[model samples]
Target: MYIRERRRFVAMSLAAITLGACAETSVRPRQLAGADPARGRDAAERVVCAACHEIPGIAWPRGRMGGSLAGFGGRPLIAGRLPNQPDILVRWVRDAPSLIPGTGMPPQDLSPAEARDVAAFLYTLE
Candidate 1:
């Protein structure tokens, strides 16, 4: 009985570890480090992001000029061009026009840290 219980415990532990690893991989480290989704949401609101794109959590000043931010995290590409990574996403948020010339998404006045927070919030959209 002791051996059986020990085996079961080990199996459960392995399963838990595997699940945790999966969860961690889904979100990049940059998005996880010192990133606050709540603050990102607030930043989005302050920056009037909803004025162009329809954000899932924020429900105000929604506009149709930009693509909906729904499922943004799951997307494989940013701006339908760059890879969907934390660094790339942050840069895109900070200066979309710089990354992609003529992008309708105007450059934001957000600082680097603010952009990271925004990226964290966006990563939660999945």
Candidate 2:
């Protein structure tokens, strides 16, 4: 247990350092053209997204339930089923349950634009 805690602390520290470097820069979103990454970063916090997913930029969550999105940009699939492409990613971000019935996530209630922006921010993670 002590080792686990120590590892967690180290990993969290590394994540903070890595994300701090990219705090001001915006990666061009591949999923949706013209999607604003900065807005996406803010929207993720506004929506309390880290409640489910371990997002890279914001460090508070460290969610235990959902998977970490540390390298979402390079991932090959969305839910281990759908291909991680632009249109599909945008839709998945907005409504995971719509794509996969009985999915654990509830309706995210994000607008189309907000979803696009959130998706953009997710894709920025290296």
Model 1 — TM-score against the truth? 0.75
Per-residue lDDT tens digits of candidate 2, residues 19-105? Answer: 753442233335477899899889888878799888888987777577888998877667777756666777988889889898877
Which residue pairs overlap in candidate 1's backbone?
A: none
Quick one: best lDDT, which candidate? 1
TM-score of each: 0.75, 0.73
**Which model scores highest in TM-score?**
1
Please state every model's RMSD to the true fold in angstroms.
11.2, 15.0
Q: CA lDDT, every prediction? A: 0.85, 0.78
Q: Report the poorest 10 consecutive residues by lDDT, candidate 2.
A: 20-29
What does candidate 1's lDDT look like per residue over 14-67, in tens digits? Answer: 999767655554654335588898999899989999999999999997898997
Q: Report clashes for each candidate as comma-separated counts.
A: 0, 0
Which 10 successive residues of model 1 have the least lDDT summed? Answer: 21-30
Q: Which ranges of candidate 2 are over 4 A from the true structure?
A: 1-31
